[model samples]
Target chain A: MIQGNKKKFNVREIREQFPALRQLIYGKNLIYFDNGATSQKPQMVLDAINLYYSKDNANIHRGVHYMSQQATNGYEDSRRTIQNYLNAEKSEEIIFTKGTTDGINLVAFSYGQLLSAGDEILITAMEHHSNIVPWQMLCERKGCVLKVAPINKKGELIMEAFDALLSKKTKLVAVTHISNALGTINPVKELAKKAHAVGAKILVDGAQSIQHTKIDVQDMNCDFFVFSSHKVFGPTGVGVLYGKEALLEKMPPYQGGGDMILKVTFERTTYNELPYKFEAGTPHIAGVICLAKAIEFLSSYDMEAIQKHEIELAEYAQDMLTTFEGVHIIGEAKKKTSVVSFTVDGLHPFDIGTLLDKQGIAVRTGHHCTQPLMDFYKIPGTIRASFAFYNTKEEIDFFISAVEKSINMLR
Target chain B: MTLEEKQQEIIQDFAIFDDWMEKYEYIIELGKELPIIQADKKTEDRLIIGCQSQVWLDSSLENGKMQFYADSDAIITKGIIGLLIRVLNNETPEDIAKVDLHFIREIGLQEHLSITRSNGLVSMIKKIKMSALMAV
Candidate 1:
C-alpha cells in the first residue's frame, strides 16, 4: 500500500513504509538517529519475511519436495539480488553470512590460515571493533604482524602514513568504508588500487557505506567486501560477503556441516561449490529473502537524492549544533556520511545521551565499539547522531535544540 | 532519616515526576548532591571497570556501620550511585549486605536492569556487600 505513491523519493510516503517511525517514546515523537547502529525496516521487507515463513519454509538444496525447491529458489534469488546490488561479477561470488563480523571471521579463519608469521595484515585506527579484533585473533593464532594505519585529527586516514605501512609483506588490508563513530569516508577505491599495486588483498567493510552510498565492487576493485543486512534496513542475522571468485575457490570451506559437504566418510569429505561451501547449515532463509526485498525497496527510490538528503542533514545539523558554546564536533572530515559525533566541553557523553533519551532522541553514546578511536581523541566517548533517508530536517532542528537544552542542563 | 526511610523518601520523590525529562532533571540534581570522594582515593584499585560509563566506588566500615563514597562520569550513573549510598551509608555490615534496593524498578527506571548499566549497578552493589562481608 505504501509503494503505491507515484512521486519519486517522496519521503513522507517512504517514511510511511516503516511502521516503527510512527511510535512515541516518553510521550514525544521518536527521533531515531541510530542508523549507524541499525536502520529501521520497511513494510515491504516485513511483508517479505511473513511471506517466506508462511509459504516457502523448508530445508533448501536437500529436500526433494516442492516446498524445498521453492525455498531454494527464494534463497538463490536473494543471492542474485545481492549480486546485482553490489554489481559483483557473479552470484557465486556472494556468500551468505550471519553478519559483517561473521563474514570477516570467515576470511580471517580460512584465508588467514594461509599466512605465515612474517606476513603483515594492515588495518585503520578508526575501524569498529568488528573489523579490528578478528585480525588481532588471526595474528595471535598465526604469529603474523598486524599493522595499523593512523587517522588524522579530522578522522581521515593519513594516506602518506598508510603507504609507508603497506609493503610486500602485507598480505591483507582490511579497512572500513565509513567510520561508524566518526562518519569519515575513506578513499576505498584508491586504497584498493594501492593494495593491488603491493600485491596485497583488501577487504572493504561496507557495513556503514552500503545504505548511504552507491557501491560498485568491480569499479572499486576490492578483493572482498562485507556488509550486514540490518544496517541496510533488512533483517538482522543475515549479511553478504562479496569476494573475488578465484580467491574464494582457493580458500578452504569456513565450516564443516551437512549442507557444506558433498560426501563424507569417516576419514575424508569433499566440500560443496563456491558459496555453499562457506554457508554451512540451514541459513537465515527468512532473513535472506527479506534482505533482497529491502534492496528492492531501496531500488525503488532515487538513491543519489536520498544520499544527498542524508548528508545535508549531517552538515546542517553539524553547522547548527556547533553554534552552541562548549560543543566540540568530533571527526570534522571534509567528506562524511550521515554520522555526526561530538562532545560538550567538560560534560560526559553519557550525561548528554541520558538527557537526549529523556527527550525521546535516540543517539548512541560511549566508545561505539571503537574504543581505540575514542582513546585517540583522549575522551571517554562522543554523542553520535546518524541519519537515514527517512529522517527529516525538522527532526534535525528538534535534535539540535534538545542537545542545547541537554548541555545547558548539564552545565 | 534511617536507611529504609531514606530510600522510601527518594522513591517518593521520583514517583512525583511522570515526565522522563523531569525525572532525569531530578536524577541530575541527585547527582549534584553526591559527596565528592578525595582525589587520593580515586585510585585504579577503587575504580569499577566495565561500567557503561566509568564509576569509582570507595567502601569502608566505620564502627560496625558500612560507609560508601562513589562518583561516575555520567550524571545519571552518579545519581544512581548517589541513591545507593544514601540508602546504605550508615547501615551495619549485616544490613548493607542484604539491603534490597527495589526502588530502581518501582520508580520506572527499568531499562537499567537489562544492560551493562544494570551490570555496573550490580558490580557496585557487589563491591558494597564484599566490603561488608570482609568486615564481618
Candidate 2:
C-alpha cells in the first residue's frame, strides 16, 4: 500500500505493513512508543527473512554450489544496498558487523592501531555508551588520552567545548549523530569539518539517526559511520560500518577467521581484501538479506513527509505534557527527533512506565544506558516515548491521558 | 498467622479489586503505609540498583524470627515490598527461605517476578532469600 504512493505518506497504510503493530496487549491495542530502542519490521522484511532461510541457506563467499552462489549474491547485494543508503564512495567501505557496538569496537580496535600513546580521542557527553566505551578501551590499550565534550541543559552538544578539545594530538573524534536518550541531533557535518581541520578523523554513531533522517556518509564527510540494522526496521544481530576505503585499507583486520583470511600457514597468514578482511565468520545471511529489504522498504517512503509526521507527533506530545504540573520534559533541543522524555514531580519513572504498560503503551523508562547524561540532569531517569512515522497524534493523546492517570495513581 | 495464611490474606485483599487499576490503587495506598527504612540504612551495600528503580533492603533477627524492612524509590515497588514483608516478617529464617509467596501471581503481578522486569523485585527477593539462608 505504501509503495503505490511515492509522494504522499499515508501513515495508516504504512502502519499496516508492520504486523507487530496491529496486535493487542493486555486487552488493549498496543501503542508502541519505544521506536528509539528498535523499530517494528515490515512484512516484506519478514518474508525476505523466511525466503532466504527456506531456499537460499548456504555458506556465502566460497561455496561452489548454486545455493551458495545465490546466498553470496544476496549478501553482496545487501552490502551494496547499504553503500547506496549511506552514499558511500564504494561498496567495499560498507562492512557488515554484529551491531552498532561491534561496529564502534571494530573502529576503536583497528583504528587505534594507527594512534600513538598520548594521542587524544574526543567524544561528546550525549553519546550512547556504545560510542563511549570502545574509545575508552582503545585509550587504555594504546595509552591514548580520551577527552569528552560537554553538553548544555538542552542536551545539545557544546560546540565550543568540542572545538576546544580538538587539536593536533586529537587523532579521532567520535560522536553520535543523534542522542538516543534525549533525541538531540548533533551536527556531524560541522563536527567532521572541525575534526578534519585539526587533521583528526571523525566517527559518527548513526544508530539513532539512520531510522529518523537521511544519512549520506560522503556528504557528512565523516571518516566512519556506524548504525545497527535492527533500529532501522531490519533484523537483529546485523549492522553496517561505513568507512573511507583509504582508511579501512590502512587499518588492520578486526578479526581472524575463515573468510577474513586469504592464505594461512603455521608461520605466515595473509588477510583477504577490503570487507572480507573485517567480516571474518560466516555472517548472518538471512539478517543481511532482510536488512536490504528493510532499506528498500524505507526507500519507498518520502522521508521528508515521514520526518515531518514524526517530529510533529513528538512536538504535540511535548506540548500536551507541558499542561500538567511538575512534568519536566528532558532534552528540549531545537533540532530534536520524534522522542519526548520527561519526568513527573514526586513520581518515579518506573512507576509511570508500569502504569503505561498496563494501558498497552510501551515506553522506555530509566537511564537508557546513558548514565553520564542522567547524572548531568541529576535525574534517576526519564520516561521516554519515542515515535516512529507509523505512530499517530491520537495515540499521543491517549498517552498523555495515560500519563495523567499514572501520575494521579502514583501520587 | 502462618506465612501461608498471610499470603492468603493478601490474595483475599486483592480479590476485591476487579481490575488492575483498583488493585494498583490499593497497592499505592499500601505503599503510603509502608514503614520507611532508616535513612542511615540506605547504604551502598543495602542498595539494590535495578535499571528502573533503586531498592534498599535492611533485615534483622528479632527473637529468632526474620524481620525485613525495605524501601524503594518507586512506590509500586515499595508497595510490593510491603506485601513481601507482610508475608515473610516475624517468620523463622528457615521458613522465610523456604516460603512460596504465590500471591504475587495470583494477584496478577507476575510480571514483577520476572528478572527482566528491571524493578529490582527479583533481586530484592534474592537478597531476602540470601539473608535468610545466611541466618539459617
What local lDDT score does residue A326 receive in model 2, on the 0 to 100 scale? 99
lDDT for model 1, on a 0 to 1 scale? 0.89
Candidate 1 residue lDDT tens string, A245-266: 9999999888888788888999
At residue A75, candidate 2 shows an lDDT of 94
RMSD of each predicted structure: 1.9, 1.4
Kindly list the per-residue Cα lDDT of model 1 for residues B1-136, writing each as its tens digit.
7767887898888878868888888888888877657778889998886545777889777887878888877778788788788788888988776777778888877676566554366677778888888887
True contacts kept of each: 0.74, 0.83
| Candidate 1 positional error at A239, Å | 0.3
Candidate 2 C-alpha lDDT tens digits along B1-136: 9999999999999988877778888888889887769989999999998988889999999999999889999999999999999899899999989988799999998888887786889999999999999999
Off by over 4 Å in 1: A1-7, B116-119
Which candidate has the highest DockQ of all? 2
Question: How close to the true structure is residue A316 of candidate 1, measured as C-alpha lDDT?
Answer: 96
Poorly placed runs, candidate 2 (over 4 Å)? A1-7
lDDT of 1 at B81: 81
Candidate 2, residue A320: Cα displacement in angstroms equals 0.4
C-alpha lDDT of all candidate models, in order: 0.89, 0.92
